[model samples]
Each structure stands twice: as C-alpha cells, then as structure tokens.
Target: MEKSEFDLIKSYFAPLASGYEEAFDLLNDAALISEKPQASTVVTMDTLIAGVHFLMSDPAGDIARKCLRVNLSDLAAMGAAAFGYSLSMAYNSQIDVGWVKEFTTALGEDQQRFSCHLIGGDTVVTPGPLTITITCFGSVARHQCLKRNTAEVGEDVWVSGDLGDSAAGLKLLNKELDVSDAEARAQLIHRYRVPEPRCDLGIELLQNAISRTAMDVSDGLLADLGHIARASNIAVELYEDKIPRSAAFSALMSSSPDLGLALAVTGGDDYEIVFTSDPAQEQAIQELSRKLSLKLSKIGKVVSGHGVRLICRNGKTFLPTKAGWTHF
Candidate 1:
C-alpha cells in the first residue's frame, strides 16, 4: 500500500509538533513561531546523506537522532536553547513506512529529551540515498549569543568532553582501525552514531558570562581552532598532551600511538564545545565541570601569530597531514 505524504505527517510528524501551538497541527503550509521576550533566535542547519554522513546499514532510529543532534550541536555552540526545528527528508526507494516509523520514533524521543518540537517539514522521494536535513531553532538572551570566537590573544582555550572517539569509531565501522577489546569497540561505534551536544554548557557560558566567544568542534580540533584564529584574528598554541580522550578511545588506539594522536585532534565529529575564556575563569570553569558532571579540558591558549601551533611533549611541533574533515 502506498502512503501519501499527508498520511505520514498526520500519523507521525504531526504528533511530534502537537505540543507547540504555533505548529497548527501540521495542517497549514507554514508554521508560526512565537518569539520569547528579550531572546534572540539562533538557527542552524545540517544535512546528512547515506554513506556520506552515515552508513546506509545504520539503524533508522540512530540515523534520525544523528541528523537532529548535529544541528542541535550548532545551536549549543552559539549558547542557544533549542525550541523547534523543521525537517526535510529526501528518502530513496529503499526507505519504507517501517523505516520512517523507526526514524520518527527516535525524533520524538530526542524532541522530548531536548525540550524541542518539530514545527513543519517536507517529505520527498529521491533517486539518491536517504538524506535528512534539519533547520534547528534555538533562543538565547538578547545580545548574549556567542558568535564567532572572540578569543583574545593570551586567553585560555577550553573544550568540553573528550575527542576522537567518534573518529576512531568511524574507522572501526569502516574496518580501517582495530581494537582488541569488545567494549572499547562498542563505545567508539556508539560515539560515531550518537553525539552529545553541549547545550547546557553553552547556556551557562552566555548566561553566567563565562565567555563571549565559542564554537562547537565539528571539524577536527586543529581545523576548528584555525577557524577561531581566523575569526578572532589571533593565533592558537595548543599543548598536544592536553587533548582529552576517553578510556575507550585511548584503549582502541593504544597500539598505534601516532595514529591515536592524529585521530584525537583531526578525527572530528566529537560535537564538543570549544571556547576561549579569560585565564581568571579557570576556577569557575572547573566548578561548572563539577556541577554539570562533564569533562572540560583546557588544551591551549589564544596566542599572537597566525594559524595553530601544536607543541608536543618532546618540545617539538607536531604536524598532521590533514587538519580536519573536508566535504569537497
């Protein structure tokens, strides 16, 4: 039986948006968004395609979570709290109603977890692989939104959560990396499939005035630091040893130390928050870490110069073949 787009929306997507009065039950062509007092809306979008952003064989529910989570991560970088999102799904012939049910179920779960709703979306058939695009909306205090890195030369650089687990996870999924421990392999793969966005940390950074500049680490740490340097017109001096890694990632890359180091900074997809702050805030950041029960590492500093410089333990500079992921 062929299901019309309206049928799918009425059955699944509409329920996701029902809590939001502005969504109009997904019956209208456009949904209305009511603005909150003294709040600025933050908008970000990400598109994930089968085999490009995720493996085709990945579970439908996992794929749905990944698609929404990536966009939410962007909002977190800007110190915004997610409110709603509009989805555009371009599904290929291989996708069916069961896959969509699994997918929307996951979206519903995350929507509740994040306290956001789906306002509207479009469903279309495509010859290409399954593609999911989400334009996520978030809100922050007026004039308190974190923009590009406003890092000052000599300020400390901090990143929330560990790095490289996702990259290592991808390698394991692709059969390019090997880990002897079954648990480590499972952890890495999970990181690749699901990312934890640092939304709470972002809100604190803005509301508590911890930092004025921040960005989510989507690309490798080095590549993203370069972005911060360019945006703030400052150089970054990174201490190689300061990069954070989970027990799982360290275990997986234990045998290949060199590869492990490279993957830690260049692997990307960690979805952690990286921000520059005054050195005085170090203690405050530590307190926040304890309060939030999240790991926050000070890995580098904003320096005077151009680009990023990574200093190894041997007092030598380590250069990677690639800085981060390049879409082209």
Candidate 2:
C-alpha cells in the first residue's frame, strides 16, 4: 500500500513543525514584523528554476541556500535588514523525503545567517524541473533607505569587494576555464556555489548615510550600473582599471587581458554593493570603514553623459560590443 500525500507531508514535517510555527509568528498580520517601528517595509521576490538557475544534479541543500541568498541580495540593495521570508517549492514526484530534509536544513542555516525567520510557504508536486520561489521581506528607516534613482552628479561610485568571482566561477563550472592550482579551483567553486550577500555592509552604509544611492551587483556591474544611470537620468564613467577583480582574475588577465575584462563585464552574480557618495561623505566613509573593518573601494564617478563608458588606465574609452547579460 502507498502512503497518502497528507501522511507524507505530516511525517516529513512533524518533528520540525514547532520551529516552523515559531518562525511564522511574524506573518500573523499579512505583514512582516520589524524591530524598527518607524521604518517602512521593503519587499522583494525571486524565483529559481533548477535547470536555468542551478544544475538538476546540484545538491538540494545548496539550491535551497542560494534561493534565499539571492532574495536577500535584493534586500541588501535597498539597504534593508532581513526580517523574515516565505517560500514556495515545486518538486516532481522524483523527489524523496531525503531531498526535502536536506533542503529544509539548508533553509534553516540561511534563516540563521540572514537573521530572517522562515514564515510560511507551500510545497507542491510538479511535472518538470524543481522550482523555488522565495519572497523576502525587510525594513529600512524612512530616511535611510537607498534608491537607484537617488544618484547625484559628482558623487563617487564605489563597490564592495571584487567583481566577477561568480562569473569566473561559473566559467570554471562549465569547464570553459582551466585552473591549475587546486586552492584557486576550490575558491572559485565556492564562489559559484555559495554567494555571500553584503548584509552587514549594507546596513552600515544605511546607518551612517554614507551613500546617496545604492544597488547590488547581480546582473553584472555594467548592467546594474545601467539601471542606476537610467533611473537617475545621468551617465556613468567607469574606470575599467578600477573595477575590482580577484587575485585569480589578475593571473588570467596577465595571459589574456581582453578576455578577462570581458568576463568581468558580461558576467553576473557578484552580489556586492554598488553605491555612490559625494566628496563630503569621503571622510565619514573612511572613518566608518576603519571602525568596522570593512573594505570599500571607489570604482568610478557619476558624469553628465547618458550611458556607461569604460575608461582605460590611461583614460582612453572603450565601448563593449555587448553591454551585459539579459534574461528573456
């Protein structure tokens, strides 16, 4: 005899039901609870398809973590604090109890890391690839939240950490790039498998008002910068030499400069913060970073033009054959 679906759901979730209920306490009012009462809520949603966003062969645990992290990255872009989230998972009959257990375990870990409670969600059987849709909710002080359209002329543009790690990591995963060093290979693979959203840096930037506007680098730096440019009605002059790259990236560039930089531009999934600040905030940024031990680097400036231009180290401009990635 086969077990009924209700029996299966109960057996799988029974042991963890109490913890799940605790997490869902925030959802009682159709709104996420916030510690800062005066802050306005910021909500975002992201969906991941197994084949498009991850390998069908990928571990359910990793897929679960990445699902939540990607949503959190959007909250970080708004400089919001992660408070809670809900999820919907669609799995085929091919999935097993073991897979659900692993997926929930990863979700639990991410819930802890992001300081977000897992509110409530639904699980259903589907016919195709695994699909996970996560809705994340966060909060930001009314005056502190950053917007893409808030960029101003003469502000210094900065990004946290290096860009293109995920892009290179994906290349390595696809076997398009060869890494001779075992350690380097491990680093790149980790970047691809697990991206760290800059929550701490984002909150710090908001609290100190160090930036006028901010966004996350997800769909490639140039693509994301284009969003700010379009929204703010201003152009950006990005110094290609200033775009941060990992040590491995520099090694690759030494052999093929053009290809390496192209990967940096067209690649995606960096998740670092891209923000702008005027010179008046320079000393404040410096002081805050020193106190917090966070690394921030200036990469460009807002200009009077319309689109993005890559300026060389010697100040020559080069236009990209293609600006960045597009999802259709």
Candidate 3:
C-alpha cells in the first residue's frame, strides 16, 4: 500500500514547518507570510527536473539540497536572508515512501543549517519526470536590494569562489572528461551536487554597502555577465587569466588551455555571486574576503559599451564557441 499525501505531510513535512508559526502546521490550504518591520520580502523560485537539473541516479538527499540551495542562491544574490520556503514536489512512480524519507531527511538537515523552515507546499504524483520546484522567501532591508541593472561603467567586476568545477563535474559524470585523480574526481563531482550559496557574503555586501549590483552565476559566468551588461547598458571587459580556478579544476584541464578556460566560463552551475563595484571598494572587498574566508576574484570591469569581451592571456580578444547553456 502507498502512503496518502496527507499521511506523508504529517509524517515528514509538518515537522519541517515548525520554524514558522504562520505555517498553520501545514493543515490549511495556504500558509501566510508576514514581513518584519523595516524589512521587505524577497521571493525566488527554481524548478528542477530529474533529467534536466539532476540525474535520477543521483542521491535523493543531494537532489533535495540542490533544489533548495539554487533558490537560496537567488536570495543570496539579492542580499536577503532566507526565513522559509514552500516546496511543490512532482513525484513520479519511481519515488517510494523510502525515497520520500530520504529526501525529506535532507531537507530537515538543510533547514537547520540555513535557519529556515518549510512553510507549506504540495506533493502530487506526476505521469512525467520527477520534478521539484521551490519558492523561497527571504527578507532584506527595505529599498536596499541588489539589482542586476545597477552595474556602473568603470566599476570593478568580481566573482566569488571558483568557477567551472560544476560544469566539469557534470562532464566527468557523462564520461566526456577523464580525471585520473580520485580526489579530483570527487571534488569536481561534489561541486556539481552541492553548491555553496554565499549567504554571508551577500549579507556583508548589503550591510556594509560594499556593492549595489550583483547576481549569482547560475547559467554560466559569461552568459550571466551578458545579462548585467545588457541590463546596465554597458560592456564588460573580462580578463581570462583572472578568472579563478580550483586546483582540482586546473589539474583536470591543464593540457588544453583553450578548451579548459572555455568550459570554465561557459559551463554554468557555479552559483557564485558576481558583482560590480567602484574601484574604491576593492579594499573593503578584500577585507570581506578574509573575513568570510572565501576567495573573491575581480576578473573584469564594467565599460561603456555593449556585451562582453574576453581578453586572452596574450592580450588579444578570444571568443568562446558558445556563450553558455540554454534549454532550447
């Protein structure tokens, strides 16, 4: 016999909603969210299809974490602190009671780690692929949220942490790339599975007034940069050499510099925050880096023009085969 939807909610999800009082214990059709004084609500949503966002063979817990973190990353981009989330899970036949247990267990752990709760959501059986959609709610200082179109000409461009590991990790999983080092393989694949949302960095950026223009690198660095550029009506001059890479990532692509760098910038899924700030903020950013213990790389600067230009190590312009990933 299969578990009923209400049974699953009581057994697994209700406990997760314990963080917020207004969740109504998930008994009501909808949960009410109220904003705090002087704080504005920040909402972000992301959908994950089994084959599209993750693999069916991937660990159920990891899939749940990834689904949640990606949306959290969006909150981080807006310099917001997450409070709770509503999850709509489209489960397929392959999902069983045991699988739900594993999935919800991870969500419980992450809720504790992120200081959030599952306010409300729906679970329905799907005839198609297993899908997860998370609508996350966060709070930010009123009228003080990061905006993509705020990049200013002559400001320094920056990226947090390393890039390309996730993309390369996916390639390793698909057997398109060969990595001989076991630790390297693990490092790359772990990045693909779990992303580190720079929540602290976002908070610092907002609280200290270090930057005003920012977004997380989700769809790929180059492609995402294009969004800021077009939105701000400015051009970006990216130095290929300045794009940071992890030791594992560098080792994996050492022999093929061109291909390696291309994949690193265009592979997407990095989830690191990218922002533009005045050159005067460099010192503050460096201090923040040390405080957060996360590497923040200034790879480029905003220029008065359109689109992005990748400057090669040889001091010449280099164009990638493709800018980034697209569903279509």
Model 3 quality (TM-score): 0.97
lDDT of 3 by residue, 104-178 (tens): 999999998998999999998899999999999988988779889999999999999999999999999999999
TM per candidate comes to 0.97, 0.89, 0.97
By TM-score, the better pick of 1 and 2 is 1
- lDDT-better candidate, 1 vs 2: 1
Candidate 1, 1-328: lDDT as tens digits? 1689889888989999999998999999999877877877888999999998899898999899999999999999998999999999998778888988999999999999999999998999888888889999999877568867578987999999999999999999999988778998988999999888888999999889899888888888888888988888999899979999999988777788878888888888889998999999999999999999999999999989888888998899876555443421
lDDT of each: 0.89, 0.77, 0.91
Candidate 3, position 128, lDDT: 96
lDDT of 2 by residue, 175-219 (tens): 888888878777876777777888877787887788768888888
Best prediction by lDDT: 3
Give the Cα-based TM-score of candidate 2 against the true structure. 0.89
Ranking by TM-score: 3, 1, 2
Q: Give, for candidate 3, the lowest lDDT window spanning 10 residues.
A: 319-328
